[model samples]
Target: MRLRLLVIALLTVSFLGALDNTVVTTALATVAGQLGALEHMSWIVVGYTLASTVLLPVLGKLGDMIGPRPVFLSSLVVFMLASAACGFANSIWWLIASRVVQGMSSAGLQLMSQTIIAHATTPRQRPKYLAVIGAAFPVAILIGPLLGGLITDYWGWPWVFWVNLPVGLVALALASFAVPRIAGGGRARFDIAGTITLTVGLVALVLLAAAPGQGVMDLWMLALAVLALAAFFVVELRVAEPLVDLRHFANRTIGIGIAISAIVGVGLFSITAYLPTYFQMAYRTSATVSGLVPIATVFGMLVSNLGTGWLASRTGHYRPFPIVGTALGAAGLATMAALPVGLPLWVPMAVMAVVGLGTGAFMSLIVAVVQSAAPAGETGAVTSTVNLVRQIGSTLATAVIGGVIAAGVAALLPVGLNAATLTPQVVHAADPALQERIAQIYRDVFAPVFGFLAVTYLIGVVASVLMPRGRLSDSSDVVPAAESVTA
Candidate 1:
């Protein structure tokens, strides 16, 4: 009963963590209106994401050093406080600051969730629970925008933050009572220099991705980011107790696992990244309506993740899922690129469903793959690093594919009067001829983005095929309450 409650609490935290990412996306316009910071809107998201990405590896190391219980509890408390602070913010900058704190704490939430489950369950049993936990991400993302829009419209933007207070409190309570206090062993000293350099590099990279179209400035930023990250690796090698076991990075299982994780990360972003703009521009869907569009993908993901998880648990065979999943994912993305703009809504929904099905199967097994491949003491490190690579991939997709979309849209826009400034309202407000032209422009812009995504998905398929095979190991040394880390 206690374990069940703990699992529930952990899953709740995961849902909340995922919700934070997309919840603010839909609330941006409303929040900007009230705070009058329309120009700085993206910071609300960029700050949280940058902070979260930077912390994943760091906190994973901390979890191993001091034990996860204290770190996890502290994070939960900080998040609760941050949520309350977010609700009472008077300006956009204040809210962004609160989000940064929330991001710091929330960064460890999902990682701890997966790590805890690994502690509690055998590898064979882990997948079913992990798959359910995996489902929370896409589901929360699917509902976040819609939930945010509804709350912002009906209750107010403050309620968006306020809702977290009750759920977080409940999660904190359950975790306190149920989560076992694991004692730390003698892990080597912390690598402060590696941590600092990594932070500088990741923040710069995130800023570059989040910043809009800075030409020469972007090049300089990229160089700094590369230098900082490169220096970080060098520092890690020299450190007594490195942040992670860099030696294991070359292990076929770990290396291939990270490669697969990064590929799927990019593939997933490519397909879903521009959907809202596509819906708004081409179909004239309301923000509320477009927010719900991802639900189709969520549905596909949930079914496949759960089903394959059951099969993997029964058979202890994990390779086939990603292979078939990525191939199908590639095909689905290609289908999406081939879709006509004027097709019935069902067509796009069907394609999204296919894409989601593929991604779900591919994604659910990532942690499992790494955990099975990693040695007893290094599971946390491998898991955290794999997730970090995935984050980097998403950032790369945002930078590269986002640029493609912008340039494609700009070239497609008709000359003379500026079409870039035309909103759906503005376009509809114009004459029929202009409206038709604007609609055609949306269709033209979508093809290149979708085409690029299809190719990315194909690359994912190749990576999946290249995935290294090893016997799935379920011998986790760190069990809750009493287990020890085996070297």
Candidate 2:
């Protein structure tokens, strides 16, 4: 019972972190209008993502150095304080700054939550727990926009940030009482140089991907990212205790799991990011209604996520899930690509469910594979690396897909129709013929993008097939760091 409570606390923290990533998305226009920074509104989302993503490995390594319990509890405290700051902010800049701190703290919460779970459970019991935890992310993603809209309408935009406080307080109390104190390995040398280079490289790379213009500045950013990343690798090789153990990539199971994780990130983000807008433009649905449309996909993900985890734990066989999942995902995406524009809404919803099913199969299983393959005392590092790769993949997908849609609209839209200024209201206000034309342009653009995503899933299927054949250990022994905890 105590163990279950600990898991609940960890999941609550994880869910809160993930929810903030997207919850403000629907309320952005409202925030900008009142806060008076219409041009920089996107930063509200980007700032949080950028801060959290860049610090993932840092926080993970800290968990390994000092202990996950202290880091976890400290993060909960900081996250709540930051949330309060965000809620009380008087300007957009203040809120963005607060959100950056929130993101930094969230990085700890997310990384330590998973690290604690890996320590608290044996390899055999890990899958089911991870599966339950994994469901929080997709659930958060699915409902974030809907919840944001409702909160903004009824209470106000500040309530979006305020909402985290109550949930966070509950999580903090449970964690303080229920979480075990895991000891870290004896003090290791901190890799300051490697950390610096990696942070620079990631910041540059993410900026390059997120930037709207493809100018000389972008080229410079790309070059800087490349040079910084190359320097980071060199530093990691020379450092006494590197932030990330690069050698982990040489292990077959770990390498393959990371590759599949990237693919899953790309597919998952591409669908979730675009579908709501697609519904708005293509079906003329309101934002709230469009947000609800993705529930089909979320439903499928929940069912498959729980089922696959249970089966993996019961049978002790895991390799086949991703292989089957990716194949199903590819088939489903291919069907969606070929779907006609005029089909009833149910048709696309059904297809997205298949993609979600495939995606869910990969979620918890990939983490299990990578962590199971880690050398004792290195689970935190390995887990953080997998998450980092997945996040990078998602960032790249967002950039690439955005470029594709922009280019397609620019080419297909009639003269005088500015793709940059196009919105659902603009389209609705336009003549009927123009609206139909805009809809068809989106259909043409998105179809090819979906087909491209399907091809990526096929590649994932190939990667999954290359994964080592084995059953995860059923041992009750915990990781070295948590061996002292009797519970």
The predictions' CA RMSDs to the true structure, in order, are 2.4, 2.1
TM-score of each: 0.93, 0.95
For this target, which candidate reaches the highest TM-score against the unseen true structure?
2
In model 1, the Cα lDDT at residue 84 comes to: 91
**How many steric clashes does model 2 contain?**
0
- The per-residue C-alpha lDDT of model 1 at residue 404 equals 74
Model 2 lDDT tens row, 81-105: 9999998988999999998999889
- Taking the tens digit of each residue's C-alpha lDDT, what string does model 1 give over 1-487? 7667767878888898889777878788888789999998888888898888999989888876776777788888888899899989999999999999989988888777777666666777777778877878877876787789899999999888888889998988888877666655447678889889999999889899889578999998899999999999898888877776688777776776687778667877654767767776776676556545567877888788888887788777788888888777878878877776666777788888888888888686877877766664555667788888888898878778777767776777777656457666676577877766766777777676667667776777776677776445555444653333422
Superposed by TM-score, candidate 1 places the C-alpha of residue 211 at a distance from the truth, in angstroms, of 0.8
